[model samples]
Target: MMRFVQGKTALLVSAIMTAMLLTACDGDDGQMGSKGDSGVDGASGNNGLSALVSVTPLAVGHAQCAFGGQQIDTGLDTNSNGVLEMSEVDSNQTQTICNVTQNTLAVDLVGRYQSGVYGLSAAEIVDYHPLSQSAFVVNAQSGKVDVLDLSTLTQTAVQDEAGYSLNNIAKKTELNISVDTGLTLLGAVNSVSVSGNLLAAAVERGDALGNATQGNGIVAFYRLSESALPVYLSFVEVGALPDNVTFSPDGSVLLVAGEGEPNSAYDVDPEGSVALIAIEGGVPATTATVIDFKDFNIGGTRNSELNPLIKINGPGASVAQDLEPEYISVSADSQFAYVSLQENNAIAVIDIATATVKRIIALGLKDFGLDANKIDASDKDDAINLQAYEGVYGMYQPDTIASYRWNNTDFIVTANEGDARDYDGFSEEARAEDLNLDPNHPQFAAAQDKTQLGRLKVTTSMGDENNDGLMDKIVAYGGRSFSIWTAEGQQVFDSGSDFERITAALLAMNFNNNNDENKGDSRSDDKGPEPEALAIGQIGSHTYAFIGLERTGGFMIYDITNPFAVSFVDYVRNRNFDADFAIDTDTGEVEGDASLAGDLGPEGMKFIASQYSPTGLPLLLIGNEVSGTTVVYQLRLQ
Candidate 1:
């Protein structure tokens, strides 16, 4: 953590002089010892320093300082040494000596924990058990959940011949899921959720050759133990390619999102569905209710309410097989579950009581013609530019979604991190500059209209107008922002250009850079920050939303108490984008231990309120995928 001292220099100098005078004359002189043995050690000197001195500008006219990792309120540092002296220690008295110099509240990086190999890969999703004061981290590649004891966490500084480094140490234990299942379960752990004493993890099972099993997935259940560990309880079989798992508000049900994604060959695709497993007295029901979307096929007339811009047919697949469920969020009343159909650009509402699909909310295209919706649409661009153009549309294909309530109304928030249906056998991508434009369309009168449609990369699956089998309009991927929608699927609010504008303002040195720390607009043409995961928590009297950026490697905080007028609170990144990549000289490939400058590719996060927090302060836990690390941040009101 970075520390700063703010106050009047003149006042500080005077205080130091006064402290020196007091130190010289205030101590009582001991009786002179005339004859002490040469080897005798006098009195064991006063037990070191009674107190460490530090001075900080009063926060709201009250002294605040941190000593020995604990925040304390002490009087002025009369010695001007940023440490409290024994004479200056007075915890009960308010310090009125220093004047307030700064008004901005700041976030301090109090703790950080590492998971996998330093430079390799490790963590993805994390869930915290407030009662046990422990955190569960999903190690996706290793197929294990590492349980970390938060009480053992300590901050230490080590100095070696090389240099001085600060480290956060904690005790950890791992529970490997593959040890029991073996090759039968070929995929990595995708997501995890915890409620009460139960923890649920979604594991995508497949064959020994790594081919996805036909509608086969596993939900591993575990019981949280008082020993700060999880004991395996049982497992339940569900649909194929289960990407996300969640628990109902009351913990009476477990919801799984079966993505059912196809193979690279574009063959043998399974239909997407949702599974609801009822829990009775901490035990799963004998049979799970699988809610499939075959009835709501894209080609069916009843499903025409879906975005007409969506391509009805994928490679070697039908509409029903293409709606892949990505993530899920339950209603506050536990009556409905909202699932994001990422690839289809729609949201599926499932009735928990009936265990059936109630409705599919289509998230229509985002218009880029307006100034607020402008984007830097080309990776080839040298600099970041936000400008509007005609005939450009983007799909709000959200990856992670959450739910909140305000004024008794329910709302769904989404991270529009766009995805494409690209496989080894079939890919649907095209550059706008390479496609032939429709002549009759008013926007593009000529074939070479560079201003409107030159550098944009669009999907060829949609935007075909005039029934001439020609591409008249361009459809891009991702909205590059977070959005709020009504339960009925109407758009309520969109962050629009705020993400880019705010990020640029905060991270001016590395704006629009990738996780590798490559500078310039390398990712602007792509998903642009790729807002992948979202978690909301209530702090004080306000509700805040934490949006994690997948590519840019950090999270943004927003005060969303009023959805219509959300305000940006802060932006934090823990990754070392500027660190040098270790490379093998012979093969020219990156090698060996990498620097843990910060967290990268945050896939999952959890927020703990102060009431349940071990530190008596709000906390945010993040699981970063690329860096394979989990970091715990203590939130303080400045």
Candidate 2:
């Protein structure tokens, strides 16, 4: 047994020594036998799984931000498909990105097109067509629409004959609204709107003397072409005196604000209405749905619902005849329209889908006694003295209204420009001193001084709440500011004395100057730096409001991103403050260096987004009624 054990051990040692010698000759024991199939391949290791990212554009009414922004999504490819699907996106990794974190928003004049003629309604309203790169200006003096080519437009600043810098733009052509149309358009073009290759012009019927008539107006459609004249299409009959016309976002509807103002004699008053024209395949209907204000008449169903603050004091006129639709702003979804009733100090809400009046919201009075709502109440004061008086309130009679969406909610912006019932038959405007005030009135002493509130224009229609012989409250004409209201007419934000304060700070030399004449403090008694034209635009991730000062000759910029916390951004005026400008009211002739006057009396404004801008930058187009010019301003970030 000992011999057998020793022989086996010796054999085992020999086998181990042989194996060791073979492994050393092959140097590392080959490669460990080729990676065996290992049963079913263990599911192929999931293709090494990848992490992915995606970016998409957010719209205006996004939940994350008021202004549009970028949405970034990131996730791991859990399914090994190499895609960050919505379902696979990691909510924790999702982010909302906006423009430059910190940037200065500004605007600079790019170009301006002048009409040579001045002191007339030569350029009242302006609208731009991106495809044609053209601006349609309401040349009321010629009763036509002047189309200016913006395709070849360069910076307005150029070398003049004397080698001095001058700004100018070329006129492309004039559209004859009277000719070629079967209807007799004897009146001037009041407004123009452009959307996708289509141009709409509001044409009213007039007498042979060019005076507005009680007949229905028309909205003429034209095809805008880049290389050809605007081809006239059919016309849709709206109510009398269509003051403003607008196209819906989807281009499927056209809204018209029928002013229906009475004649000078006040005997032929017509009912104010809103017309909704349906467009099928780009062609407007022959007739429109004229939504009247009859439901809000004195004895109508909605009469009791009307707010007491609404001014319905028109002589022998019902609510239907007194509520003039001065301007119309449609919601982003085109489902609703808000019409400004300037004379009535109210706004009519219309349901576009149903073509009916939803409600009428009366803009209440703005108390001047409050510190945030003071005004320069006297043109004869010889200085900018913004004062607040006890018992003094102002009617927010807005002129131009604009709508925008913020944080999934709707807001309406307005230029509280004010208006009065001044006619041969009736006039409600009176100077504060001219009004007979009660002895107990708080501002009676100040009302007797022309240098104080005496010269300020106030409406005699109000203030006499008890219908006594003497006045009680001193109600002024305009709020002298701009305001922001919710869709239901809840006052959210008001500029208050910002307009007057800003003008006084930046343009003290020309404070409250008039459009026709550079007379400082002349308009203070009426409407100090009347904020007439307003346009809201989106620059980067911020929404800005541009307000045009009709009296002071400039525009104001406010960052309205957080409407409740609006901040003043900037103010721009291209006018020559040193130059003396005047116009002959009777002769309609300029008596000063109109060329050096720059832009005056901004009556209409249009904002062009960067994507649709001719210069590939965001732009703002303004129509100056007094200067008869259309100025282009480029919005930028630095």
Candidate 3:
């Protein structure tokens, strides 16, 4: 027995030395030695290192490992045994096998690009050029399109840290459309849409600055160059004041929303219309088919009686003139176009194939008296006191609209950023304090008091619910939340006061303020956290809607997969409220200073999925008009 034990001990020592040598070698060509039987009493012989243990997988990629009741974090399991050897523990290893999934989404501020041209409001509309890995931003005030190259962005490793830092670089090329066309472009570049090689831009033309010429708007088609610049191809005349333009999914058609706003003097109002241009063989047709609202008069008349729900009191002479198409959203199938009639507080559905009005859906007023829909109408209140009232009403005047298909059903989402016809010559906005309330009503006592009503701003055009031609109640602009409607214009879901409530909770003292990023309730009297822009994208197994607040200046992300039970994901804002405002008091124009603030007034947003993202991660691009800035964010999913 003594002789047998000595021989077994010698064999075990030789086997251990051979295993050590094999682990010392770089490659896995060395086969693991055969395991010997355990010693008596089940104890590991030779310094407690188990000789029979062998790692099933020598190389572990992004996986966890344990040895001796301790966690092994190193990427390389140097020893053939699964246990971590003391000498094999190296902190310099690049990979780590974490127990938990390390891919959790890290919402980080990756890049911010400034326009440098102060007050130009450089970012109104942004579209990504997938082939070039670039972004096209419309400089609204400068009448120029800026192209930004995103491929040059690099991530640098932080010293003595586990994560990396991205460099905020701004390299852009400004393409002035006026330089190529020789036509004086006015009212900024309202919208931009991109297809494979075609880039469409809608530029409102005017006889002079600030005066939109009647029936003079144009849609310019440009071919993207190999050098990442837009080469002007040709332009076609559309209607007056083309506010928004978009391309079909298959690039077969182009739709334009011609606002046709009336002059300040309430005279010379052109009919609001939409233009459809067919794209044949990568070229837009010379002329567009103009679709107007003359044929679909509700009462068979062209006056305000055409649509009883539309209150045309400000400057518009007729129903057709009052229906200003603020934004255009094309259906997923490219067969329908939904136009948002902002001031009219209605949505017009148009058949793209026939170029005719299908039906007009009036988005009726929202009752603020309900408990689910409370609002802080008074800016005089020190804090955000959302209370239900009996007589207050709000118009669902959506400014930006988007259509998407969920579970094979088509739905339209609107950002209810209301608008009033507040012009120099003809103004329709008045303080709530100036309006008279019904004395018999219970809220009349509170309305007569000057504290809250004096500070509240309401539109005078939409009141007089009895149709007696007398202002009986007060109606305010903007619903202050987003709404989901069916393709046929039936309300499916509404965010109610979630926008204001969530913003108040997240921003605290800085809720309901303007784009300057200050902490004040100044904007509460007008529009509370006015939701202006919306973009939707599917990331992994969830669909998200990115809502941008034009007043509060932040993003409200929601998981809209189940429209009935939508859940909030996150709220992010990048702004500097302490920035000084450069204002021209006489002209009533404010110049943006990017150095003093982050992005402001997110008027346009675009979501890029990971498959098409240049950084191999999902991205969200935001165009801030007030700050004339564009920011790119990377979404890291766990």
TM-score of each: 0.78, 0.82, 0.78
Rank order by lDDT, top first?
2, 3, 1
The sequence of per-residue lDDT tens digits that candidate 3 reaches over residues 1-638 is 00122254355456556655544444223334457644334323233222232222211111132100112223235455666565655444322222221122456666667765444566888888887788889887667788888776543212211111223546567777777677764557888888778988888887553566564798888898556467888888888889888888878999999998877766667878999999998888999999888754446543342456766665536566777888888888888899999988899899999988887778888888887688877767777777777778888899889888888888888999988887777887887767665565546666655445556678777667787765666788889989989987789888887777766765665788876535477687887888998888888877778899987887877678777766556667776556666533233265554356566788999888787777788888888887677878777664
Cand. 3 Cα-lDDT: 0.72
Count of backbone collisions in candidate 2: 0
**lDDT score for candidate 1 against the true structure:** 0.71
Q: 350-423 in candidate 1: lDDT tens per residue?
A: 99999978888889889877877877665554555666756777889999999999998889999998888888
Better of 1 and 2 by lDDT: 2
Worst 10 residues of 2 by lDDT: 157-166
Each model's C-alpha lDDT?
0.71, 0.81, 0.72
User: What shift in Å separates residue 339 of candidate 2 from its native position after superposition?
Assistant: 0.5
lDDT of 2: 0.81
Q: In angstroms, what RMSD does candidate 2 have relative to the true structure?
A: 19.8
Clashes of each: 11, 0, 5
